[model samples]
Target chain A: MSLNVGVIGAGAMGTAISQCIAPNTNKLLLYARRKEICDDINEGHINCEYHPSVKLHKNIMAVNDLCDLKDVDVIFLCIPSSVMRQTMVQLNDIVSDKCIFVSTAKGIENKTNKRMSEVIEEETGRSAVVLSGPNIASEMMKNLPSATTIASIKKKDLEIVKNVLSTPKLKVNTNHDVIGTEFCGIIKNILAISQGICKGMGINDNAKFAVFTKSYNETKCIIEKLGGNRSTVDDYCGFGDIITASTLNVSRNHTLGIWYGQGVYLDEQTGVLFEGKNTTIVLKEICDKLNIECLTVNFVYDVIILKKSPKKAFYALWEKL
Target chain B: MSLNVGVIGAGAMGTAISQCIAPNTNKLLLYARRKEICDDINEGHINCEYHPSVKLHKNIMAVNDLCDLKDVDVIFLCIPSSVMRQTMVQLNDIVSDKCIFVSTAKGIENKTNKRMSEVIEEETGRSAVVLSGPNIASEMMKNLPSATTIASIKKKDLEIVKNVLSTPKLKVNTNHDVIGTEFCGIIKNILAISQGICKGMGINDNAKFAVFTKSYNETKCIIEKLGGNRSTVDDYCGFGDIITASTLNVSRNHTLGIWYGQGVYLDEQTGVLFEGKNTTIVLKEICDKLNIECLTVNFVYDVIILKKSPKKAFYALWEKL
Candidate 1:
């Protein structure tokens, strides 16, 4: 059975998903907002914006209109969370009811405080799977091996997702906790920023270890309170991703954190989009509303909101210690 | 009230501990096996072998004889695990029971499979405290801020250990799970080697996450079976240290794992000691006797004992996955 695959969005994650799916499937239709990107992908067999080095698989075809994917068996949504709801609503009017969605975007809707998958289910009335880990797009394009988890509420959908996403270079495991998995993907970014702050502040590995310990404990508590399995963050999406994002020099959030720690304004940084900045604000608000004692989040909030230097933020933390 | 501080070794960690304690204590006694090291410290006020840049505090007095520390209130044992028992025996004959011991050495005796803290308690008949985390001696000596946990069986002893160890740049948290804390410090080296193997084998962050997840789960199970709090490893000494050691390029165990992963013999490498190699064999034997199923340990055993390549080791792991 050759399932029809459609990737919505021409972002790095979408391109990577298309590349991974191209080898296993008979047809891969990639939907891009810009007509030129779709044309380039179709005619040149390359995603010039995201993955331009390797030639895309011949099975892939690009479509400019969402209606072109009316028969897609599975659609991977990689659009940013800000426009996810509007896109999903528009997608619901065109795509068939049988289409399954797998979201790679990691974020919570500020307006509703709902996860991307939850928003997907609400807007399109379709259950969606989430795929996330310490997936750095640049490394994946270099053909380096990596692992991620595909989580779905349904076991059958999870198995199908595993079959579709897993490759020799990209190992995909099935996770039952969609909420926990999604939360892990989002919360790690904030923690990674804190790690960068630690590094920029000239903190040693021993101190970083303490900060991570406290952060992970707080993350577990939030996961459990949200009616999700606490162990999800302890695995790939949480512990692994957080460590990679925080410690790896090239990570955007980490870089931003370093700049922030060094007293550089977030806007002054040129070539990076720090997801942790937004996540920190949203998460801090949530924590305050729920009375969750998340010291790491508060410290990050002080840097991002209160405009405190890394030294001052650390001094505040020392008082609690 | 002023306390008498005695550091049992003049190695990097011993020197760092002495440096941290020098500003707080009234009398700091550093005991070294070589009389020349003691003479150099007392005369020149510098431990060139360990920390060359930092001048020793004038209050520090170095002594070569063990009997000189008999009246000391606290002694930090920082000698290597191979010589721990012999050193403890010598100290026990001289030091009074009131002189509490704080061990920073992280290792398990091959003959007894007992942790360093256990050995200290058994030999000296004193309940000792353990100081462990990602305490990189070189970084600490440079006054780079760091944090670690101080664990003891008793709350009173834990408080005293915290007071002795906690400095402005070095934050110390108290833990009651001494068994779990000690095991975390010892086991992380083996796990770090596994991480290095992954990096050497060209494995991506995804696969590494899976490996760590399984390793941590197995560790928690083992800790629980050993009658220790399972959550102890989830803190600084376990998760924090393991991640830092594995990811950091400077870690010796990670470097050793990389060499082994690349098919270099253990003995072929000079100026490096891989504690994980010995830990793998000893821990495997321990797990076997206890009927604990630890896949990561078994994989490491296959690599070291069976002389399997990373490719073969991962292939075996894939079957289980």
Candidate 2:
């Protein structure tokens, strides 16, 4: 059951995922776009930039070329969603035909609104496995107790990915609802930003959680409309991740929302990429096309994108409640 | 419609609720059992025992006699669940037959496991509206924006109660799922304690939220099995209150779980009532009777009532995850 696993990207998530699965895999080839990071990882056995304190597992080998992943049985695409399609196209050309792709990116393709897995399948002609949950990369790097949900069309692929990913300290739940699993990751960003906006606006607990409750239910509705089970929204990727991102300060999207809520708008030079801003725009379009009304999405859209006053948007939201 | 309103119990919640509805009512009579609290509220325009800083509305009158509520059109029973039945029986003998009763207590009857609404119905032979949400009394006292859910069998009663309770700052949503609304309040205590136990045990965020996701789904399952709609758990009472009590320091149930999780057991002589302890014992019995397997319930039961090691119980729970 020991498989050759390739993890694409050398960012915090990529390094952390590589560390988590290295013990279970025969060889974990982590593909870093930068030659320097690969050299650092291979020579010193440390991802010094992301995780400096801990030594990398012996089974993990960092590679600068995507061709090094050709022999891998599984590839975890931990790259950003903006680059997911291009990376998948390159990996499709290099990797083995039997290699199962796992998507950890949590965004829909801008304009086309295709999910990461959809884009991967269109490019690679294979259904991609989706991984998501309340997994903080720092916590995962430390091997603190964590759990995640993985979804795929093929049950065997799910079993293989589950085995590759799960440890006594890192639990993995498997399901067949790819749409629900992927969208949970996307929708959670909106939830995080919405909660963050309320927090930044100094909204009370009762009102904040009430809006949050509405947002949570609206998520189920959106997922169900997209042909996924409503019950899937109760899984780790949905309830667990939404709460983690919205309530905790770990998420960049939540922080972005907080800044907008407090009337401090960051310019493009801020350096932090907020996936939620893109998500909010894409989801608003999706909801409009589908004739669905989500107050949470509208609230975030009004405040973040339209640059409307948070108080005015909040008052409008309160009126509907 | 300036209705005559009466609020029983001058505790934090009762006083806060009275303060919220006082402006909308013709005469808001807040009933306190103690003469001293009533006198203080009446003479000083404040419930000194519960809300000292906020001045009581001029329309709000503090009364000590149950008979004082006889002329009221609506009565909000904000007393402890332990004394709910006897108080309902006493009110049944005094209040007008047309008086609408609102049960704000969030606990079930000890032996019968009857919901507060059911107990009020059994004692008074009248349907009682149920009120619940992520309401923090201290926040509500400050006229902070808050929201709540109210449920009753009669649609007319729902309308009347909604109008009586609704304010610009206090938003109210109405539903017909009395069972779901009541149980959401009852089960949230369990959720709060479960999350608190994880916090006290210093379990990682991923595992804690993963278990919380399970408990939340199990709540929907239990409610549906008890003849309530599963979707009701998505409402303010379920999602809102669960997050509020579990995450915040406002709930005594959560604090109790933290103590047990930390292995610092407090004697019963400590004045604070851990309603969640009674709820856990009762819910365990109920789940056993209904043949429902809830890991969250079992984990809390092991750590608190059975005095089992938190580490052992957590391991058992994680194995299932």
Candidate 3:
């Protein structure tokens, strides 16, 4: 069936996904927080703060209200984690039943370890899917090759996602294992931060790589142990994405490592968000509750958020490994 | 036990390993092919091809004859895969009786899917330990941090290998999964070439990441299916080393990917003998013999070696996935 797509957040991710799918030709709607924001978007197709280089589709328009998107067949929640709950609260009644719920956000609700898609499904009272991979929004806007996994419980829902998101430049792979995909996306940043901190340690390249491999395997174990698919770790939504996220400057957490290398503090101009910051706490809780080694995430929490020296946290975690 | 480390070959890999262990106050022997080569190394500490940056150790004495190493406690076979069999045959009778062997070469003997360690063992009539990891000769000269794996079917042999190799900058981890680590070092270059091809496709970041994940999983499958330890995929010898090999310019294979993207051929200047060029053929044969899916490696094979256009090979592989 032909689909009408609605992007619920006119941020960097929203722009990237919008460009990935149909633009002027297909029925499309974009939702932003304010009319001024919509005006800025309409006047200039680019999101100035995020993707300053790429332009947007002419047919894509920003709306101040969710009811404006009622006719759309799929809704992509691209808002940040902090605003997702409020955004969902406002759209719950307005969103149509025909629309497939999907989230492009990469955070776990600290209050609950619920993934973004979980929160969407819970808020909208409908099954939801999550899109996760190693993505740089700026690069996606330039129509550079990228891939991501769309995860949902139903194969039909997955097909709908594939239909809506696929483009010549953006390849979307689907999996029935939503938990594994979402879990990999959220937890990887924490690992990236831990990786950053390890580079901060006096440890040489060998120790850094050993640490990277060990922490990644440890992350995979936690996800797989929780009844998620082992094969998920083999996909872009898993290992490759995690590597890009941890190693490249494209990631906020990876940037944390760069800053740590340069001895700079995490600040606003970093234009990077520790997407896993909220989830680090939740992950530690999950580890504590399950008694599985959440060694990497815990190391990140202690070394980064709590201001613990890598020497102390590294040894603490090193002993466990 | 006090160890006498003997290194065969005076080129980069051989010289680096010799220098690494020479500072330990051990009697270090360097086997050179020509008399002049031995004299040059004895007179000056420079290894022309591999590491020109580091100074050689005073304890290292270059000898042209193999019998001079007969009293050595450990012998490292640092010859290329092409000539290893011939050298192994010569060393079979000359090596010390209790000397454990370690190999610095990376490759599967092209015509026979035999690993470097396997070739050395058969040639020397003794299975030397395998030193597998992403150890850069140039980086090793700088004494940069890097890690490697030392493995043997025998526990005592592995212990001997580890103690000799483990240093502050280059820590050696022990494992029984010698085969797995070997495949990772060889196959990752092939995958790095694939990574470059995807980059050349100019696809979005997510799509690129997705292809990487698929390639990684597929590589893991080929290794595990061939009777390797699966856990090494997340260890320094395997995944970590692969990361270093694939992601950076330090890898010949990675450079090959860049050349493939730029429409150039990967050759000797790539830093190391790019195993992907030949290993893909061996990998194809191994997979065929073992009945495993080596989609990523085989894809690179068809494109790079078989002279098929990359576009056609990519689409063919994409459709199957």
Cα lDDT of all candidates, in order? 0.82, 0.92, 0.75
Write one digit per residue (lDDT tens) for candidate 1, span B91-125: 99998778889989888886888899889888888
The deviation in Å at residue A91 for candidate 2 is 1.5
What lDDT is reached at residue A228 by model 1?
78
Winner on DockQ between 2 and 3 is 2
Instruction: Evaluate residue A120 in candidate 3 and report its C-alpha lDDT on the 0 to 100 scale.
Output: 76
lDDT of 2 by residue, A1-321 (tens): 699999999899999999988999999999999998999999999998989888998999999999888999999999999998888778788987899999999899988999999999999999999999999988899988888999998999999999999899888888999999999999999999999999998888888998998899899999999988788888899999999999999999999889998998879687877789999999999999999888999999999999999999998988887
Residues forming the 10-long window of minimal summed lDDT in candidate 2 chain A: A266-275
TM-score of each: 0.92, 0.97, 0.87
The better candidate by DockQ, 1 or 2, is 2
**Chain B TM-score for candidate 3:** 0.91
Model 1 lDDT tens row, A173-212: 6778998999988888788788888887777677776787
Better of 1 and 3 by TM-score: 1
RMSD to true structure for each model, in Å: 2.7, 1.4, 3.7
lDDT of 3 at B282: 77
What is the number of backbone collisions in each predicted candidate, taken in the order shown? 3, 0, 14
Candidate 2 lDDT score at position B80: 94
Q: RMSD to the native, candidate 3?
A: 3.7
